[model samples]
Target: MPENLTAEQWRSFVASRRTTRDFLPTPVPQELIDQLLTDAMTAPSWSNTRPYLVAVASGQARDRISTELLNRWDSAAKALAGGLWGKIKIFITRYGLPQSDYKVNRKYPAELKPRSARVGAELYGLLGIARDDHEARRAQWGRNYEFFGAPVSLFIFTHRGLGEYSVSDAGLMMQNLMLSAHAHGLGTCAQGATALWAKPIRDEFNIPKDYNLLCGIALGYPSDDKVNTFKADRLPIEKIKLLPKNA
Candidate 1:
């Protein structure tokens, strides 16, 4: 709770967060993101190994990724859809259910979500995009390639050699970044889309060779009320929680 702020203001600030897909074009100073990354590192880690690294892509670097990734996605879309120009085709059909499914299967590890459409929905919702507006939605997702036009990007990585426990540590670090981003009134989206393109992106950004890309964080100022409106899906508390022995 904030003693400097009323309880309402404190709660409102902490409660605000969204994986923003659209962003204003204005530049965020490097100092702010630097402070954010420093705060993010404060997140708890196993034995304090602190293996997290951030690779930022801004300006030209940001533009390159945006162009390439969108091009790749557009190519896949065309090939799967047989270059359809109009009408709302079912996602699976438009993308060739079998082939798209195979791509998902081959690309993602067991833990990552493989559905590109599902990821798109979460992103568009954060930006208040309407359903069936495929162009708008795709354009919004393209913003990720543009680093949400934030001028800074934070890539989360972990050592390939770490055990699940260390992976969990890295995850905690990601959460810290998300929470702190909310507190700072900055919008962010945790982009797993890059997971499939990790190697390409890693090389593209000149990331150190030892790091494996866990995910990408698209950071920036929201174009609208992204923080408040981007509600999350959650299960009931009872569905996910149970006391071990004190029932």
Candidate 2:
């Protein structure tokens, strides 16, 4: 264990970590990526099952996957705007429907909807995108498939057999990876949108049948774009804490 680490310092470091929406094209050194992965592996696993795998992409492979994902997104968007015939075409071609092992898009719960909406509003507001600007919004959303211009993209997978526990373990691992990257002057964005269509990743990687793609992380140096500076509000500690039963 490292010595002389104060709680205040740790808290400050953790608070500085944020989800980077824009990244520079500068590629992270392989050694640095390896070190971050090593640190992330220290996260405790449930029953030591460690039922998760990661697929890292950079250079040519990353570009190819990004191209494919963007193509799919474009086709899906056109289909959505095509009316009844478009719907029929999507059904016939299986183009618009997601082929993810798990559902990535779902209706938010009533209690959580406001939080989700608020963050989204703030993010788009930072980018000068109006709520009614469908075309602009679609273009922005398409960037997620492009890994937000990050040079490195990671796809996280969880074992289907372990169910929710596997997802929980993956979450812990992802947090560690992000924090480790942040500590090293790197940026990361954990993207659920990348999990919407797994076909592109499946085509590029030899992922096992038992492993389901959970999400993705875009890692690299953060760009100085104004969008990257947007910060969402967090709930207070009291709001998250449960009341004492005796009270």
Candidate 3:
């Protein structure tokens, strides 16, 4: 345990940290951004490899990336409607389809599917969006590409050499970054959808070929919007814990 840090304080802080889906346009200070990055560097890495890279964008750069991503989302959403015409559109407009370095669209395992579905249902419920309202849902999902209106977007990349371990290391670093942001009274949302279209980000930054875009984090002040209040339920410890063989 770190000095001056108590267990209760740590637990409370962790529990208080929520996934902020709505953000204010207020920009986070550059110095504070630097501090958060520095703090995140302290996260544990596999064999001290620290095989992760981050691309930060703010102001005009962030807006440009958001624009490109939202455009792609619009196309992708149309393609999902499913028809010969949708297929032709994707084929003609290649940029509308996924140009991801890694696969982002994946089915959840049977055990985890319900949890994922419940969270989605609850979020939409809070937003007053009906489950079958595909248009509204697509719009809500589109918010991910816009960084939830955050002023800053940090694109995380993991070194392909280390494979899954590098991804794990990146996840740890993101947790550190998000927690640090929360501690500073800033909000952050780790966005998986941001990884769906990496071309927009790659166009803006000179990312290495060996580094695969894994995810993104939106960093800024949270808005007063009701969406920010949604919280996903966690499984109880007993549900997750495995019993001893003898028992």
Candidate 4:
């Protein structure tokens, strides 16, 4: 006989989870969303203050927000794509060739420094998005605005002047929500992309100006037919470790 399926089985099960962008626009029950929020609040926080807060939107509000985001993205992308051959190279390379009135880099915790593309690649593979599909990939990125078609959207944030520990706490809580969503048969995308929309979103959602927009996560039952399915690999433990000097 055989023992129960071991590490491989568990890995395969979790690995099947992926970031789904091709949403069916079906309505998710309010109770289910409620449960997710409940689980999200359980996330660890510094001094147990749980400074983070969430805003959920559905129906017309969701649609309007996505529309505005797409319009802004199109205008910004076109501007970046415009210019003479010489100028275009500047956009392609390093420098001051293509500048935009709207281009923005979302704030990140420099102290909590992390490499985004590495994690993004894992999700891209699971989403079945090709490495070279810049346009397709970017369009997929825009899905964050639509809550990835899940019919509900979540906004996450914290006070602007939080200390380092608080930001870390928020990140931990976010991770808890994402993992809980996964364990509950929901697909989620940890959306740093939406950081660029912070100002617009803060105004749109009526959040106090001093709260820092941390990130967003789009959650829903994944579409079986869509290309997205499976999880990306995490960095090996060895890669993340440094030998202790005392040892």
lDDT of 2 by residue, 127-171 (tens): 999999999999999999889999999999999999999999999
Candidate 1 local lDDT, 124-166, one digit each (tens) = 6666789977677666545545665665566676665565665
Question: Which candidate comes out best when scored by TM-score?
Answer: 2
Compared with the true structure, what per-residue lDDT tens digits does model 3 show for residues 15-134? 999999989999899999999999999999999999999999998889999999999888888888968889887988786888788988889999999989899899899999998899
TM-score of each: 0.71, 0.97, 0.96, 0.73
Model 3 lDDT at residue 148 = 89
Q: Residue 127's C-alpha lDDT in candidate 4? A: 72
The regions of model 4 sitting more than 4 angstroms off are 1-17, 84-134
- What are the per-residue Cα lDDT tens digits for candidate 4 across 1-247? 1478588876786566666665566776888888877877887777788776676767776667667666666655554556566446545653432122123364556743365566677667767789998777777766666666777667677765665665687778776676667777777776665655654565568776556776667777777754564444567789779999998
Clashing pairs in 2: none
The per-model lDDT (C-alpha) reads: 0.64, 0.91, 0.92, 0.66
Model 2 misses residue 109 by how many Å? 0.6
Report how far off residue 167 is in candidate 3 (Å): 0.6
Sort every candidate by TM-score, greatest first: 2, 3, 4, 1
Tally clashing residue pairs in candidate 1.
0
Which stretches in model 1 have alpha-carbon errors above 4 Å? 1-11, 83-144, 225-228, 243-247
